[model samples]
Target: MAMMRNITIGQYIPGESVIHRLDPRTKIIATFLYIVLLFLVNTFSGYACSALLILLAVALSRLPIKYILRGIRPLAFIIILTLSLHFFMTEGHVIFQVGFLKVTQEGVVRGLMMVSRLVLLVVGTSILTLTTSPILLTDGIESLLKPLKGLGVPAHELAMMMTIALRFIPTLIEETEKIMKAQMARGADFESGNIFQRAKSLIPILIPLFINAFRRADDLAVAMEARGYRGGEGRTRFRVLRFTYKDVVALIFVAVFVVVVSIYF
Candidate 1:
């Protein structure tokens, strides 16, 4: 369960670097455009351009490359599974054959490309989450979705819910680790069984986890009530969000990135 403790995907690191100082709205929009660009990428040249931008962002953020990438460790199995499925399912000129299974050169190339796309997607999103605080992220999202409030979208509430969920990821992970250890101490075998048996072993853990989650939710609700909290109606923020020249520059950078990757690169 050590994997559960080191989840850094949604966790933020405090910094005063350029990337961190930029408006959260700018980061959110840029991250979305980058993800779309990743899907449009097919050639090595496109990937190279994307990678260069990522490196530049990392450098500007003053965040360690390894620290950003550590989030991928828990997802290693998923990456391998995706690559394996594409390698065997795709058909082309057979490069290797073993009885009923065949490996094709085309499959190899496609699998590698798929892996690259996945890695880029994760890294791009991680950059945004690592640099932006949850409160600022919520504010940015609510501001962007303000238009939908006319259609009864409850934008502020939705953003608040998402922010709360992100904030609780690490807490949930730590809780899961504690529960797993307690169960293991009671002679529960999680690692010495087939897939079905292993899943069955998790019943004890899930029950306590759900109970504790509900309890925590109740406590939070009580606390909010005690503080006289209400919905987002007529709420005024202490920190007003403003779009600066840096935000405009970020927008231009994304526009150029999309144009070059889609049309020329």
Candidate 2:
């Protein structure tokens, strides 16, 4: 049996909260700066400040904290692997030892920092997708990149691809859940095995999933072609984007937070 509802990163939940109403460009810039801030911070205090900021954003978004945390479940394997590698391999004052493995004070601290970075990164991104509609997100990204088009960049195409990719994440998750359930009903085992065995079991699930994904993609391309769809050149947008005082305020807040935290925190 498999469950898929917990994954919320790629799905949008329409809301009337202030955070949701902010300009998509504002949110996009904020998310990007927040990720950069994550890598810039080197102290526990910096991480704490970053966590506080994320919490503030989450509160403003009015999304359920528990619901937001549910998205972290899918990253358990990566988080665990990160913790294991850093906690056991980093050189520092040894805090504990067992058999051939040991934990160090620095390692523990570094592992916690890395985990915090990952969680913050995920929550920040999840909020962006959960609050902004896909079409709006694409518009914002294109708008931001529009200035780069003079350098031979395909701004609209890049934005469309990014938005489409984000939009497909939830679709892929649902597809995976369906495939897993269908396979399991046929007596396929995905859980009752060692790590390597479990990974091997997933091959059956992934192969069909990829095939289905490609099929859907091909159908989408044909449908677009039939509808007279072309590249980004001269494409007119139905919903035009404009900035408000709120957008300016949001951008200022993120910039100040990043700059102050990086320089003074």
Which candidate's lDDT is highest? 2
- The digit string of per-residue lDDT tens for model 2 on 186-219 reads 9999879999999999999999999999998899
Clashes of each: 0, 0
lDDT (Cα) of model 2:
0.88
RMSD of 1: 3.7
- Residue lDDT tens for model 1, 1-265: 7666655655789999999999999999999889889888798788889988899899999998887888677679988998888778788999888888888888888888888888888888889989998889888999989999999999988987987788788789989888988999999888888899999999999999999999998998899779877978887879788899999998899879887886766
lDDT of 2 at 53: 91
Cα displacement (angstroms), candidate 1, residue 97, comes to 2.8
RMSD (CA, angstroms), candidate 2: 4.6
Clashing pairs in 2: none
Point out where model 2 deviates above 4 Å: 1-9, 161-230
